[model samples]
Target: MTVITGPLAKQERDDTGALLQSTLVDLLDLSLLAKQAHWNVYGPRFRAVHLQLDEVVTTARDYADQVAERAAALGVSPDGRAGTVAENSGLPAFVSGWVDDGKVVEAIVQVFSTLITRMRARIDEAGRSDAVTQDLFLSLAAALEKQSWMFQAENRA
Candidate 1:
């Protein structure tokens, strides 16, 4: 990898890289969760929820890419294999292609809730380590929270 010099300190870059690697697992796990739900969700509101799930799945994939790039920027390879995700993801694996919508929603809520907590912790770490990473995580936390609200809204509807 080419050298990077910015306002970021060397130690901060290292820490941000570690944080991004850990977040790589979260993003991938979350991506699968959204995809699984997208493919399997069914109910009275099936069509609408299914479409929303598709949007979530797509966005999750993008988020995964961003985090992986962050890891690569730090000179460490990002883990992309399913096996690595199985071993490293802090969130539960969502593998079934056929599941009840309620169950799917509940499971996804559980996953993103973990994401909120994890992102907050990472934000704290980055706040101390790298302002750039911290800025990114701050925006990420807001987006994830907004996504969580979307999931929460389903129950109210």
Candidate 2:
């Protein structure tokens, strides 16, 4: 089988590929979590929180595509399969059944907080080997941070 290759050294490629693959799993699972929350969220703020969930889903999906493509470009296969995401993702699962808006907002804030921390570490790791991958992580981090801030705002009095 022919393997795709990039400019980074073997070790660099391996490191960056691992980072991309991990981030891909996180993004895919996050999008699924947001969609679940979007569909089942209720309560007085339901409309606003439901709409916001869609935004998060969009952001996560967009970044997932970029991360996967980045991995492929580096000759690494990105495994975003459901089993992979379920097995590899460190993010917590959303509660089953109807969730109140307050709970959804609180849960998302926690999830984003965790993800942002990991994304920062990814940015640092990728920076050591590939600026190209690091740049993608940076943009994704910015978008996630913005969404996180929005979610945080929802929980505030």
Candidate 3:
């Protein structure tokens, strides 16, 4: 952790930064997954799913930026390098090559669900250390939940 003169205590900053960094890694991975789905999805709903996946990718990138910036503010070096994200991200590996619209929706829904769950836990963890960080996680979690709902809606029978 880098030296920080923030209001949070050293340990609090360290702990909170750790949680944010982890979230950043997952968000980065999820963004890539979204793009993979966007590029590969095909079927009756191909146009709709393809466009929606772009939105998901944009949101993931935005969220990742927020998490990384927050971690940096807390004095931690956010590890967002491709290698770091590849190794540390908690998200499942995305399928390569072409995929059907239904399969793409399924994969994206699963990814969003996993990320939402993890973000909720990080919100709690941040609450224990810093309310500011907790609020950040809360906002991220809300967005992820919405994305998850949207993706799930597409997959319903």
Better of 2 and 3 by lDDT: 2
Question: What lDDT is reached at residue 154 by model 2?
Answer: 98
45-152 in candidate 3: lDDT tens per residue? 999899998888898899889888888787777889999988899997888899989998888887887788888888888889989889988888888888888888
Candidate 1 residue lDDT tens string, 1-157: 6455445557777778789878888788788878778888887778877887877777677877877776666555777898888788898777576777777767777788998999999999988877766777787788788877887877633
Ranking by TM-score: 2, 3, 1
| Candidate 1, run of 10 with poorest lDDT | 1-10
TM-score of each: 0.86, 0.97, 0.95
What are the Cα lDDT values of the candidates? Answer: 0.77, 0.94, 0.86
- Runs in model 1 lying further than 4 Å from the true structure: 1-10, 95-97
Q: Which candidate wins on TM-score?
A: 2
> Which candidate leads the pack in lDDT?
2
Which should have the higher TM-score, number 1 or number 3?
Answer: 3
**Global CA lDDT of candidate 3, please?**
0.86
lDDT (Cα, tens digit) per residue for candidate 2, span 39-152: 999999999999999999999999999999999998898999999999999898889999989999999999999999999999999999999999999999999999999999
Comparing 1 and 2 on lDDT, the stronger one? 2
Cand. 2 Cα-lDDT:
0.94
Candidate 2 regions exceeding 4 Å error are: none
